[model samples]
Target chain A: MTIRQLSVFLENKTGYLNEMLAQLAKYNINIIALTVADTSEYGIVRMIVSDPEKALDILREGQFTVRMHDILSLEMDAAPGSLSKILNLFTEADICIEYVYAFSFGSKSIVVFRTNNRDKAIEIINENKLKSIREADLK
Target chain B: MPREKMRALQTERLKELVNRVYNNVSFYRQRMDEAGVKPSDIKTLEDISKLPFTHKQDLRDNYPFGLFAVPMKDIVRVHGSSGTTGKPTTVGYTKNDIDNWSEVVARSFTMAGISSDDIMQVSYGYGLFTGGLGAHYGAEKVGCSVIPISGGNTRRQLQLMADFGSTALACTPSYALHLADAMAEHGYSLSDMKLKAGVFGAEPWTENMRKELERKWGIKAFDIYGLSEIMGPGVSHDCEYHCGLHVHEDHFFPEIVDPETKEPLPDGQEGELVFTTLTKEGIPLLRYNTRDLSTLYREKCECGRTLVRMKKITGRSDDMLIIRGVNLFPSQIEHVLLELGETSAHYMLYVDRKNNLDTLELKVELDESKLTDTIRDLQNLSRKIEHALNSAIGLSVKVTLVEPKTIARSEGKAKRVIDNRNK
Candidate 1:
């Protein structure tokens, strides 16, 4: 139903993002999904991983402005219309979508979105009986 | 200057100055009559507020001799400001006015504890700027061997200080820093010169700068307040205590007034400084608004001067930035940023009107090491900067962390404010 997304502050520079990924790789922390929010000067990396708490501590030790934000994670049908069907519920409710990123989970696809009203979006997911992912389910 | 007598003499002189301006200068006369303020309305020093407020534009409208209260034959010397904007605001000094000017400057020098035995160097610009001449006359009156080396010619400025054993220096605070640095480059140490005291003015300077000069030369740094319109360079001088500058109230009556309302603010309140030339004979102003923002202290300083003292000028009303109804100065932001010590002193304020709302953006350079390969590091650092600046200025400012050397460095009087909103 929900997973904590770690948002990392990074300057928009080459080899810097690779350096961070190398750090995560050294810790053997597997990633679930990652997306970047960028401006001309800097960029923000939002990631969902196998272990968020451990990743947060590791990044905090690395001296980063790391914080956790609850994001709606759903395992929808792999069919094409299935994606639009889940998004249509949020569109009807006028819930603003900040950004959405997805990754595959075997036969099912894992999709998460950042929205203005996450609780309401979650409510819509439950009322419609859409399959939702949980934190433990990621492990 | 006793306390009771100071008030009595001010009351007496205020009445005379009001009449002189109202009768002799048409600009003052019309403005006074329009405000329904008569010369008789002023009976006390506090009653001086009833008179009309004068602005720089008022002088511009009148141009040259329009504001002079005395006749041309009586005007012995004319010193005009370099009109950077429009016509240069011209000020006249009669034979009596020059004497009074020199007398007040001499008193200011004495207040700064400068003695006749001290060798004084007047480095302030001599020509149109009154700093060099005003300081020269006062130091001369004090019987000190005056070094009339005007501004510029830094090599010679340093050469003279070393050769003549210049004991006191009078120049802009920034120029003083340049001279101090130049002395080192010229292979002259502080031991080589005999600079005992410095009276820095013609620009606003901070306590931090004073401490720097004090450490650099091992001398006392004093703030001297003045403007060309009222009197030159010696309008007020700080005593040994350095609590505040003791205004030469007998000659120039100082008043603090709200810049917008033109109403006199009570003592201890910070506002635009207004002055009435108490004994200025050539061109007496009723209440000339200086636009320099500072506070006045009525309490007697530890130096025991009965004259009113004023805080150092921090920012001018014209330099104030009104962002979303919050009043702020770029100096305040620079202060907090420098105090944090993580960033360089270089910064640029970009103010723009976005979406019909005022937006303030402070772009500060981040030391490369502060940002590791971590993503959240810069974001958190920027948030911390935003919080500090918000607390300092009480306005939520958008903070942008740029790479070092991105912001331009200034050689003289750093350009801090960039108002893109007007464009």
Candidate 2:
């Protein structure tokens, strides 16, 4: 299972985020979940949008430098220790998570991650019988 | 000499200078020949306008000593400055050339009221740069007991200023302020030192710097203008009037001309400053376009020197910054930032190459009062800055917003450009 996440390069400027959002908004795109990674000079905004391909097109057409990255997205029980328990498998496999973001909906929580070794992470995910989502499941 | 007589003297000197260069320096000879002119043609001062303009590139092309108008044995001393790339610009001075240099600088010191009784400490860096020894010989000629205190070692400078009872200072204006700072930390004030007047040169300084140095040291601050190519420091010096630099036009003739058209501009019309060395024996230059933008005033000063005075140089045509193939001056960017408000004049241009393409990153500070709790506001401010810079420079640049006082402060010539591409 894979999730197409969009990464956009952004200058650390005021209203830049709003401008990015506004550009997506014009095309009626919905941002499912997003997080920004930043240094002093510039920042990169990563997003899991309803339509990743459409969002990429809209942002790129607006002159925003965008990159499409396939990340591992999983569904977990909305319970305490759920993330830690799932993460222990990766710890055992010695796979490192580059970055991660999560959102909870009712009793189900969705976690998206970029890792150093996707194959190892995926193998661990399959061995644990972890329920992952493909691009169509988001719709 | 009177102004009219000075013009005649300059005309005669110009003719002699042209002939010397045509006969000795092959570079100038070729340029002169290409212009379809000979040494005999430069009969008057006006004939200088007909000569081909010399650029910094020409100097770089010639490299070490291709422009020397005298034999190598006649050259007693050599001075050079590093170019941006490749070879450095070298200047030669014969024994007579050194003497004349000393004479002009001595005249400059006397004009600044420094006498043999005063302990003149020269603090400009010695070595290849003309700042140090230029003031040294001049002050020594003026009978001032020169301290020969070359640049750096701040504490020692202050200590020597106190220990030696140095009565006059010669260095860049910024170093003077730095010394003022050093003195404050030593539990001493301006009155403790015997510094009466400071002859600041070797770099461009503003009138505000003069006022600040004057106020801090309780001494008069005078501007000295000279370039290594034109016989080092003492080409001109501002008298007590502080109006403009009174150029030693007799030895090295001065001209202001349109940089684009290369046509000589009338006095008071600001343009590129050009020079022709009349008395330089080792490396006589013919119409060396300094590219320093300034205006010339022919009126005699109240101090009674008949030498023409050039207005303080504002900027350089060659200091033209080209980032991402777009041409702009740093002052233009500064103007845009100041106009936007919520920022200090402080900013650093960090130019680098990303993906083999040139990228400019402007690191600027946000005004202290404008610091906001919302990240959105800061982002918006940066966007506004990026937009304005793009509009002004006609090229998009990455704007990095830094906190107040984030950018390092400079005491001397502010280090504005940090080119990271080379490394």
Best by TM-score: 2
Each prediction's whole-model lDDT (CA): 0.81, 0.81
Over B226-268, each residue of candidate 2 has an lDDT whose tens digit, in order, gives 8888888899899998889999988988899898988889999
* TM-scores of all predicted structures: 0.59, 0.74
* CA shift of B283, model 2, Å: 2.8
Prediction 2 global C-alpha lDDT: 0.81
lDDT of 1 at B372: 44
Report clash pairs, candidate 2: A13-B379, A14-B379, A14-B380, A15-B379, A15-B380, B116-B143
Residue B287 alpha-carbon offset, candidate 1, angstroms: 0.6
Relative to the true structure, candidate 1 has a C-alpha RMSD (angstroms) of 15.7
Per-residue lDDT over B101-218 for candidate 1, one digit per residue giving the tens place of the 0 to 100 score: 8888888888777989999999887877688888988888888889998877889999999999999998877678778878877889888999999988776667887998888888
Which residue pairs show backbone clashes in model 1? A1-A133, A8-B375, A8-B376, A9-B375, A9-B376, A10-B375, A65-B376, A65-B377
